[model samples]
Target: MDISTVEDALVTDAKAHLIQPWPTSGQIGAEARSGLMDGDGIYVTDMEGRRLIDGPAGMWCTNVGHRCEPIARTLYDQAMALSYSSPWYTMSEPSVRLSKRLAGHAPGDLEHVFYTTGGSSAVETALRFMQFSNNVTGRAEKKLIIARQGAYHGSTYLSASLNGRPRDHDWMDSASDLVVKLTCPNPFRRPSDMTEPEFCDFLIGELRDVIETRGAENIGAFVAEPIMASGGVIVPPQAYLKRMRALCQENDILFIADEVVTAFGRLGHVFASKEVFDIEPDIITFAKGVTSGYFPLGGAMISSKLLERLRSSNHSDAMFAHGLTYSSHPIGCAVALTNLDLLEQGLLAHAQEIAPYFQSQLKTLEDLPLVGEVRGLGLMACVECVADRKSNNPLALDLEVGKRIDAHCQRLGLLVRPLIHMCVMSPPLTITRPQIDDLVSILRQGIKLTMDELVREGLWRG
Candidate 1:
C-alpha cells in the first residue's frame, strides 16, 4: 500500500476504536508523531514495530515501569476489598493510610492531604484554598496570584488563567484577571549573567515590582513549579525559590510550589522541593508520579498553620465548600499508597542515583549544532534549539523544531515532549541503566537525523 494508505489504515484503526481529542486522534501523537515508541521495561515499540528505550519515563511520571508485581498486587487486593468509597463521609483503609504517608513525607507543616482527580485540579485546589484561607482570615483583598511566565500549572479554566504560557493567552483570552505571571528563571534563553544569588535578587525584585504596582493588598498567593516543566525544564538558579518565599512573606503573599511534574522520584527525592532548594511553600501541588501513573490521583499538602486558620470557621462557612464527587477516590488513593510503599522501599534512591547517568546521557545532546542549551537535574531535562547559540535566538516561531525531533523519535520508536523549541526528558524513574543508555543512543541518532533534515529544509545551516 502507499504511505498515506498505510497511515490512513493506522489512523482508521485508531479512529474505529478510540474516542479522540477534538483535534488530535485522541492520543497525543503529533500532526507528526515523535520517533520513539515505548516497549516493556524502558523500551517503546513504534507502529513500525521498532523498539526503542524510553529515556524519560513516560512523560516523567512512571517511577515504576511496565509490570511490577508488588504494585499490581496492591491494586488487585485494593480493588477486591473495596474499590469505591466516599472519602467525604465513610472512608477506606488505603485512603486514610495514604494521607498519613503523604504527610509523613511532606516538609514543614504541609501535613494535610486534600485529594483531586489530577494535577490541574490539585493546583486549582491549592490556589482556591489559599484564596479561601485569606478570605477567612479577614484578608479578603488578597486574591491576586503571582505565577511564573512559562510554568504549566494546569489547564482548567481558573488554572489555565493562572498559567504563564504565552500560548495560553493566544488560545484563551479571558484568563488574565486571575494571575500575575513573573519571568521564568532560565539561564540560557533569558540568560542572566547574575550569579545564582544575583539571579534570585533579580527575580525577587521583579516580583516585588509587581507587588508594588498591583499592590499586594489584592494578591492572595504566588505559585510556581519548584523546577519549571512543560514550558521547558528550566531549573532555577540557586536561592531563587527561597528568595521568592521571602518576598512572598514580605508582601504577605502565600508561596505555592506546583510540584506536578517534579514530584515523586522524578528528582531523586520524594518531592523536588526536598531534593534541592529546601524552601517550604505554604501550599504544595502534586500529581503524575503519586501512583506512578497507574491510577489517577492528585492532591495538595496544606500547611498546618494555614489549615488551622481556614478550618476554624467564624461560626458557619460550609467547610471550605469546594470539592469534586471523586475528591478522595478510594482506588486512586489505594494505588497511590502502594506506589508510596514501593517508593519508600527503594525506588526513590534508585531514581536519585540514576541522575548522574541521565546527566551523562544528556551531555551528548550538546554536540548538535542547533542545540543552544541543555539543562536538567534528575530525570527531567530540556535541550533548547536556537538559530544562534550566542544570541540564543530561538528557532523562528512556527519553525516546529521540537515537534520535528519528537516526530523523529517516534519514528525511531521513542516518545518525548517538545515544549516550545526545547525537547524535554522525563523518562520513567524505574528505567534501567541499559534502557537509559539505549534512550541516549536513540536521542543522539534522532538529533542527527532531525538536524540533517532541518538543514536541508533551510531552517538551519552548518
Candidate 2:
C-alpha cells in the first residue's frame, strides 16, 4: 500500500468497498480500516490494530470460521490448475461437480444449478428464470413476483425492487410495478395480534388480494426467505411455509426460497427447507455459507419441472436469457466443496447441539430493562432494545443507542452489528463455550457502558 493522509478513525480518502445500509457516525467505526490482515485463530486483526470477535460472522457468512487452511489450499491449487474456463461455452469439472454436490443437499427435486457471482445476482437469476419458465410453459401472462414486506432479497435494481423492504426503495420516485408486495407471516408485527395460523391466513389473504387485483394469470411466482434474516431472524410459524407452498402449487406459480442468510447449517440443516422447516421450494437461492465466505459463489437450484420445461422449450436458441461471467468459477466451486465437507463432518450438528447453551447464556439479558426480545436459531441471534420494558417502542436509530453499544463492544474486544435498536451476533460455528461466554460478558458490559454514556449526555437518566 501507498502512503495516504490518515484520519482519527476511518480512512480519510480510502473508501470502504462495502455498501452500508446504516453507516456509522462520521468516520468512527467499521468505516476505518487498513488493508492489512495479520495472524488470526478465531478473530482477525486489521492493520489499524483492533481485534474484534466478529460476532456477525462477517455479515452472516463465514460459518466455517476465518482462515481455514483446507479452503485456502484448495482454492490455490484450483487456481493453478484452472481458474476461468468460459462457463458460457464450456463447463469445467469443478463447476459440474459443485452443481451435483449442491443438488444433493438442496430440498425436493431442485436438481439443476445456475450459478452467479454472489447472492443478489442469484436472486436476479431466479426472477428471470421464473419469468422464462412461465413463458416457456405457455403462461406468458404470469409476470408478477409476489413479495413480502420487510423481506430482503438483494441489492440489484430488479432484485431490490422484487423485495418488499420499504427502506430499499425510499428514494425511488416510481416504484417497481412488477412485484406485488404482500404482508409477511410475521408474528411480531401482525396486523391483529392473531395466532400464527391466523397470521398465515391473513398473509395468504393479502397474496390472494394481490393476485385478484393483478389477475392470477399475471402472477409469476412468490419469493420469500424460509426463515427471515436481515429483516429479522424470524423462524416462520410452523405451518406458514407449508401452507404457502400449497398456495403456490394451487396457483401454478413458482416458489423461490431466498436462502442466502439461512442455508448451509445456519439453521442447523444442510437445507433449511428439507431438514428444519420441511417445505419444498421449486427454486432456491444460496450464498453466504456456500463457501463460508472463503470465496464468492452463489446460485439458483431449480426443480426438475423447470428443467423439463427448459428441455422441451420451443426455442433452443432463445437461451435461459441470463448468466454471470463468474458463474461457477472454478476456484470458488473448489472452496465451496471443501467448506461443504466441513459442514458434513458434523460442525452443523455441533452448532445445533450447543445453541441451547448459548440461548441459556443470553437469557440473563432479559432482566436488563433495555432489552426487548431475544430470538434466533443455530449460531445466529439478536437482542432488541426498547425504551420501556412494558412498551416495545424502539429507541430511535439517530439517538446512537446501537452505535454506543457497538463502540463499547469494540472497546471490549467484541464486534457486532447494531440493527436499529438490536445488537445482533452471528459468531463463527467453531466458536466454543468460553468464547460464547466472553461474547455475552462483553456485550453486557458494553450495554452498561452505553447506557451510562447516554445517561451522562442527558439522553436518559439512571
Candidate 3:
C-alpha cells in the first residue's frame, strides 16, 4: 500500500477511485483536490500547509474542534480493549455507559437509545420505529411522514425522502408518496403581506388543514429540525415549534425532532428540542457533534412512554427488525462519551456565551449590497446573497455565487460551507470572540470580492 507523494498522482488517483458524496463525477474531475493534512483548534492545514479557520465545522459537527487528544485517546483505548461487537445480540460496556449518559441529557422521558452509524441511520431508525409501532398496534396504514420544505433529514432512502431542499431529489429517487412536505417556516422568506404573527398562524393553519384533509390516522409522525441547518439555517417563528408539538399531541402524531446538527452545544445545549425550543419530541434523532467528528456515531432517543406502551401491547413479541451492523460500536461510543465530557467541562458554556457575539458580527454583513439577508440563532448563521437588495431577488443560479464567495474565503484563510446562493457558518464551539471577528472579516472581503467580480462580468448593475 504505497501512498502517492506526487500531487498530480494523488489527484488522479483520487479522481479514479473516490466517489465523493453529493457531487457529480464531472464536477470532481474538473475541480482541483486539496487534501487536508492536519488540524488544530478551529483550524485545518491543507496539503499546501495553509492553515484556515474551519467555518462549517466539518459539516456542522466538530463542536469541540479538531486534534482533540482526549477524544483520540478514548477511541484508541476502546479499540484496544473491545473494538467490535454484534449489537444484534451482544453489548459493550462503552455503549451501555454512553447510552445512560445520553438518556440523562435527553429531554423528558426519552430514555431508550437505539444507536446507528450516523445521522441518516438515526433518522431511519426513528422512522422505522414509528412504522413498526403502527404495524404492531394494527394501524399499518399510519405510515406517512411529514417533513418541512427546507428540512434536511438525511441521505438514506427513507430519510432522504423527507428532505425538501431544492435539487436534493433532482437525480435521485424518493418515496415521495410516503412523505408530505409543508411550507418552510422561514420568517425571512414569508409572504410580503403577512406579518410575523400572521405568517405563523398561516403555517399552523396549513398544517392543521393537511392533517384534517389527509386524515391524521394515516400519519405516523411529523419530523422537523428546530432550526433548518443544511437548508440555509432557516429559523422558524419563536412559537412555531411549540404549536406544532401541541398539534402533534392532539392529532396523535409522533413528533420527531432531527437534532443532528443542533445537539451537543451548537445551540449551547446538549439537546435543543426542549431546552432551546420548548417542545418535547416523542423521538429525537442526533449525530454529528455526538463524537465531534472524531468518529462516526448517532442514535435515536425513544420516549419511555412509547416504549412502555409497545412492550405492554401485543407488539411485545414483534421484532423491530431494524439496525445497522455498526450499531453500538465500542470505539464510536467511547469517543462520544469523551466528547460529552469535554462539552460539559466548558465548551457548552463557552458556546452559549459567544453565540451572541457570533450572530451579531454576522448580522452586520446584511449591510453589504450582495447580501439579501443575515439570519441565524446561536452559533449557526447564513448569509443569503441576492441580485437586488430591495426586492431580495436571488442572483442567477449559473453565477454560482456561494461557490465564488467560498473560493475567495478560502484564499483569505477561511473555509465556508456554501449552499447555492447562501454561505453558511457553524464554526467550532471552542472558537473565541477574536476568531469570530476574523471569520466575519474574511466573509466581508469575500462578499466584496464576489460583488466586484459580478460587476466586472456585467452581471449586476451595482
Winning model by TM-score: 3
Off by over 4 Å in 1: 1-10, 13-39, 191-197, 397-399
Model 3 lDDT per residue over 329-350, tens place: 9999999999999999999999
Put down candidate 2 lDDT per residue, 155-197, tens digits, no spaces. Answer: 8877888666565677643237787777766675565458777
- Tell me each candidate's TM-score: 0.91, 0.91, 0.97
Error of 2 at 159 (Å): 0.8
Ordered by lDDT, highest first, the candidates read: 3, 2, 1
Q: lDDT for every model?
A: 0.78, 0.79, 0.92
Report backbone clashes per prediction: 31, 1, 0
lDDT of 2: 0.79
lDDT of 1 by residue, 425-459 (tens): 88877777877777777777777888899778886
